[model samples]
Target: MAAIVWQTPANPPEPEDYIFFKGKRYVRPYYFEFISHVKNRWAGKTIVDLFTEEFRGRPYEYYESAVKSGRIQVDDKIVSVSYIVRSTQKISHFVHRHEPPVLAGNVSILHSEPDVITVCKPASIPVHPCGQYRKNTIVGILQAEHGVAPLFPIHRLDRLVSGLLIFARNAGKAEQFRQQVTRPYCYYKSDDVI
Candidate 1:
């Protein structure tokens, strides 16, 4: 039998990106630039109106304020709230992102192979970025901690569920694994059993 050697993740998480408070882990608020190109339907629409219709995440007043304060830009230049958008024009919206806290449990690596990496996912952490989470997710943590980027998960576990997760190191491996394992198996805690 070949001996299994354990190796540490190549990349470590940045200290400034996280905060620990009262036994919970939170991603520090940071400025994020959201970039997008004007769509055909958005052409001729005022910047404020376009934001209000497409991005309901923030209220109309917030978008208007952002435009006035230069937090929103068109083609890297500040524009008035009433500026009409044109097709192919680049838009950038800089906003401070705040992510909710999750449990302090760790994501433990179980196995690492040439084309696959497996980990024991902790509860309260999502498989990927969704909703109110970005850097606090399993994929984000692995990328920051293990230097693993562009990982493809074979299956996903809910944010509140804790279980083993398999990740493909590359896109080709991910596709191969998906074809081989037609029905991925998941282990749930007894409390979740019906």
Candidate 2:
């Protein structure tokens, strides 16, 4: 009869595992700028815009405190929750403190990126913070999930509605989107593109 031998493990501890509903598992090595893609892809938008289009369900309120703690990022750096995202930059999420970010209580993630995130917000979800929805809106869910850059709801969808709604990654892009929205489509092309 022959004797058997045993082996020992090498690595130490591993990171904690948690399930994310909206996080993009596909880490594509892509770059974007708030300028170039903003005008075309997600130009001129706010959290409310999406409500009208995707969640005409109802109205909601937003406070600075709730927005202040919201998470955001540009190039791996967690920035102002509401800071606008510039053109052609890498983006993602971080830990969010923005009052847990609200949701329509019913929605799903379609596509997400540094510059823009398309959501299928349901009609029951409010676009912004308000009522029991201070932490039940789509933005809230997103903020809670990754804690990236503060998000701006460019357009809205009805609470009961459903479709593609885009969100801005930072404040610069939010304001730029607002400005571009007021002007003609050919007015700006963004000085920054990566």
Candidate 3:
């Protein structure tokens, strides 16, 4: 596990806000994370249009600046407004959380029992083993940090989306959680509170 830490402003930021970190200490506020959040969530807009709308302080100058500065790269190349922003696509200027296979502090223990562990996973963390996020996911944190190895997540969450995630402490209970999760309302059927 690599040594990872976060630094933030004197005032805490709401979830979805961005802050720059220097080791375990916060350096300063970087930029507004709400730009991506707003652009990504809106419907029926072209990528360029979304970009222009989100970064409201400038005109063509801003887009030109982002392109010229090499701050925005897509598909390993500097992208123009023509690039389509699809689901799960990595945006330029996006701060990717790429902590190595270690216990990321992003997870919160929502519920824990002998059978399972439920967590309120932040938007930036991965849910399970995939891509560069395998061991930095919710299951990894539960097993490695919380002293529960062999943990399995009941469902998967997108890397940049916030939601509840469940991990199985044992195989049997894992399957039960799996069954309930697939049934939609089964989360309510079995756990009541989730």
Give TM per candidate: 0.80, 0.38, 0.41
Order the candidates by lDDT, highest first. Answer: 1, 3, 2
Give the clashing residue pairs of candidate 3, or none: 7-25, 7-26, 8-26, 143-148
- Show how many residue pairs clash in every candidate, following the order shown: 0, 65, 4
lDDT of 3 by residue, 1-194 (tens): 96433322222323333233442212122331112322346444445566677767557666656655655554445666565565545454533344343322456788888787788887666776554443455655555456556677677878778888777878888788778767655245565656
Q: Which stretches of candidate 3 lie over 4 Å from their true place?
A: 1-105, 183-194
| Superposed Cα deviation of residue 156, candidate 1 (Å) | 1.6
- Could you tell me how far off, in angstroms, the CA of residue 73 lies in candidate 2 after the best superposition? 35
- Residue 173, model 1: Cα distance from true site in angstroms: 1.9
lDDT of 2: 0.45
1-194 per-residue lDDT for model 1 (tens digits): 96532211232345467778888889877666677999999999999999999988889999999999998999999999899999999998876778889997888889999899999999999998787777899998887777777789998999999999999999999999898889666678886843
Deviation from native of the Cα of residue 21 in model 3, angstroms: 4.4
lDDT of 2 by residue, 1-194 (tens): 85422111111111121122453211111121111122223323332332234334443332223223432234645444345544455433222222222222335667877777777776555666554333355665555555534678887776546666778888777778778778754444587443
| Global local distance difference test of model 1 | 0.85
